[model samples]
Target: MSKLLVKLVVNALFTVPLLLYLSNATPFQALMASLSLSILAFFLGDQWILDEFGNAAATLADGLLAALFVGAMGTAYHWGLSWSALAVIAVVTAAVEFGYHLLLRRWDVRWYS
Candidate 1:
């Protein structure tokens, strides 16, 4: 399998357990926070995988898509059919992820070599 696929699988494996734990602790909101954090981490660390494949955009796109799909799954699992709650979760996740990236960029933190 390709490196990007491997990365996504690994990330999902790590995320699911973490989400489970968080869900147990704070319920659905914790799951949303976990997804946000995972996406931020993946985005910050994407350059290393991109350099390996020579396709930064592709790697980033895949990561974001995976994040959204996972986010939706988590939302569904935790919030059920509550569309309004799901919408709030989505917005908070995006905001947190974007804020994380912005802070990293402002600090000039090079997450990936």
Candidate 2:
């Protein structure tokens, strides 16, 4: 699939359940956040990190960004803080992303080499 499609799929894969588990989360809020952050990641997290290092470093950076975004939802929604929730979202996202990036890494290495 194309990069854009992959991003959408990844965002959907992670974001939907996250919103579901958050309790009292609005789909609109979740969607807006995902839309904006996915764009942010496309630039700040993905392109920048990839240029600065490699896929592994980008993965780490993406995880951090994802974690922060997930953690911030409580604050954004005035639902107070939920550290455990944030940690779960971040870890799940990171694990999923790591696998995705591994595929990308293989393709990228082959494509580049």
Candidate 3:
């Protein structure tokens, strides 16, 4: 709950601005995309992959997932985000995810339970 909220806030802080600047998306669109991406990343990357595959693998998986997810959303929404721009967004988000995974490790939240 708290972890998910924090992740949402952090992801929105990074994603919304990037989407607005890079894709010329409206604030509502950017925020919706950010929220959707955050939920997907939290469940798949932070919850499952992080527990099963460890940090480095989880980070890489998260980055790839971010790229794919955002790319799909951009296309669907006609946001016109380029592959290179998507890469930049994924890299930045992955960097933050790396630190976030570390924090999750420290907190030892009952992700499964």
Candidate 2: give its CA RMSD in angstroms.
2.5
Q: How accurate locally is residue 70 in candidate 2, as Cα lDDT from 0 to 100? A: 60
lDDT of 1 by residue, 9-80 (tens): 444444445444434324455445455545554654444443344334434444455456545665665534
lDDT of 3: 0.89
Angstrom error at residue 87, model 1: 0.7
Error of 1 at 37 (Å): 6.9
What is the per-residue lDDT of model 2 for residues 45-77, given as tens digits with 9 covering 90 to 100? 555776567677777777788778766765778
* Candidate 3 similarity to native, TM-score: 0.92
Q: Model 3, 1-113: lDDT tens per residue?
A: 99999999998999899989999688999999889989998999888889888889889988898899889988988989998899999999899899888888778956435
TM-score of 2: 0.78
lDDT of each: 0.46, 0.68, 0.89
- Point to the candidate with the largest TM-score: 3
Which runs of model 2 end up more than 4 angstroms from their true locations?
106-112
In terms of lDDT, model 1 sits at: 0.46
lDDT of 2 at 33: 69
* Best model per lDDT: 3
